[model samples]
Target: MTFAATVLTLYPEMFPGPLGVSLAGRALSEGAWSLDTVQIRDFATDRHRTVDDTPAGGGAGMVLKPDILAAAIDHAREKQPAAPVLAMTPRGAPITQARIRELAAGPGVTLLCGRFEGFDERIFAGREVEEVSLADIVLSGGEPAALAILDACIRLLPGVMGAASSGIEESFEEGLLEYPHYTRPPEWEGRTIPEVLRSGDHAKIAAWRKQRSEDDTRLRRPDLWERRGGARAQSASGARHEDRDQGQ
Candidate 1:
């Protein structure tokens, strides 16, 4: 089945931007996935089409009106009821590669792109929306995060990547950072490809790759290494949940 994606945002035109190029673009053209954008402002009831208002507790930035956001989410649900609704927020759980893989395997997904000071708190509980965070940093808006998320998901769809295993060994798939890669020139700046890689010994190469992945994860992303139970529980799989700070 096609992995359908519906995005609810104030800037509907921002979508299919970078997503319209490269692998994602190719997948979209081939019908491996689909995109639908919803303009949250379209559900506004005011003459000015206002979708945000002053923060309830007297904050500096305005907050998206819950009613307008609810309306837009409901509309998206009507069209794609099987899809899960995710609100992009800094206050949400950090997104992971495992989560992206799950979404790619599902019927589809609905993304709520927050703007201004972000969504009203009530909308999350009342609408049953799942909060998702791209990273620790903040952005001007959720559109960029949404685009990145969609790209990550789209590239995993069947037939999107040239090789089925193209994504399987990448970082996070096995709770470890990916092994370093090297290619011809064989020698660059006095550096040569690892001898084992050129030895034509598949077994040795695999062993080297696994060792590199573990060592790098332990060194570069100790957090991920720890989450997988550190060296003691190296067999652990999948992602672990972590708290997120608020972002755009």
Candidate 2:
């Protein structure tokens, strides 16, 4: 089955351009995935198709009206009933590679991109709504965050990527950063690829990669390493979890 994504936004044209040019584009072209944009403006009741309003309390910018956004969300739900509706916001859980993997395993997803200042708080108080964030930083709107999540999720879908192990070996897959990679020209500008990589020994190459990953994670993202008791222990525990789950 094709993985689907429904995006609710004010500017519908901004998408399927950047999104249509990358791996997500390839997935769409190959029928591995599909994306649908629901314009909130279309659901507006006013003659001018207005979707935003001044905040309930005094505020610096206009907030999106819940009625218009709710209508847009309802339209998206009708299109993809099984998809989870997600609202992109700064206050939500941080998006991680592990979370992307989990999302990829689902039927599909619907993204609500709030514009102007933000959405009315009532939108989030609903029973089925979920809010997700890309990072700690704020953005002009949620469109970019929606695209980011869509790209990550599409790559993990079956047949979208060239190899299943490719996504698994990427950064954060094993709770460690990815190892460095070198290509072509054995010697370039007096620099050479690591000797272990050129040796043609698979076992040695695997060990080198593992060690480099550990070093990279320890040096760059020590926080991740610390949470898992360093790289080796984390890898071992992850393997055990997989083994136990598989045996069940």
Candidate 3:
């Protein structure tokens, strides 16, 4: 099934931006997925096509009008009934790779791009939209984030990637960051590729990769390690082994 993505944003031209290049662009051209952009302002009732208004009760910035956004969402949904409507905002739950995989496996997704101060609170509740955040950091607008999200999903579509294992072996697929990779010249600036990788024994190579994955995750992303119970879950013997390996 082709993964269809509909983006509701004030800036429709910004899309298929980066998505129209690289692996995502190839997938789009191959019909592995599709992109549809909806102009939120198109749903406005006024002559000025206003889609935002001053925040209720007083705020520094304007809030996206609920009625206009609701109309745009409803219009998008009419065409993609099975797709989930997701609103991108800083206040939303942080998006995960698992969620991206889920969306890629589905029929499609509808992304709501917030602007001005952000979407009015009522739009979420009234429209039953799911809120997703790219990270803790905020952006000038949601178009960039929406583009990133769609690119992620498109790459996971079947046959989009050259090798099926390319997606499976990468970071976050197994709850740990992927192991470091090296290619020839074999030696770069006096830094040689790990000898085990050149030994031509798949078993040893796999073990080294797994060890590096664990060590890197432990040091660089302790939060992900903790989430995987890497601290408490690792056996006492395993820790001793790791110490010995590191000391080598």
Cα-based TM-score, every candidate:
0.92, 0.89, 0.92
Over 4 Å off in model 2, which ranges?
Answer: 230-248
In order, candidate lDDTs are 0.91, 0.86, 0.91
Q: Where does candidate 1 clash, by residue pair?
A: 90-245, 90-247
Candidate 2 lDDT, 162-187, residue by residue in tens: 88799888898888899999999999
Q: Give the per-residue lDDT of model 3 (tens digit) for 78-114.
A: 9999999999999999989999999999999999999
lDDT of 1 at 194: 95
Better of 2 and 3 by TM-score: 3
- The count of backbone overlaps in candidate 3 is 0
Model 1 segments beyond 4 Å from truth? 230-248
Please give, for residues 135-225, the per-residue lDDT of candidate 1 as tens digits: 9989889999999999999989889999989999899998899999999899999999999999999999999999999899989998998
Task: Summing lDDT over every window of 10 consecutive residues in candidate 1, give the lowest-scoring window.
Answer: 239-248
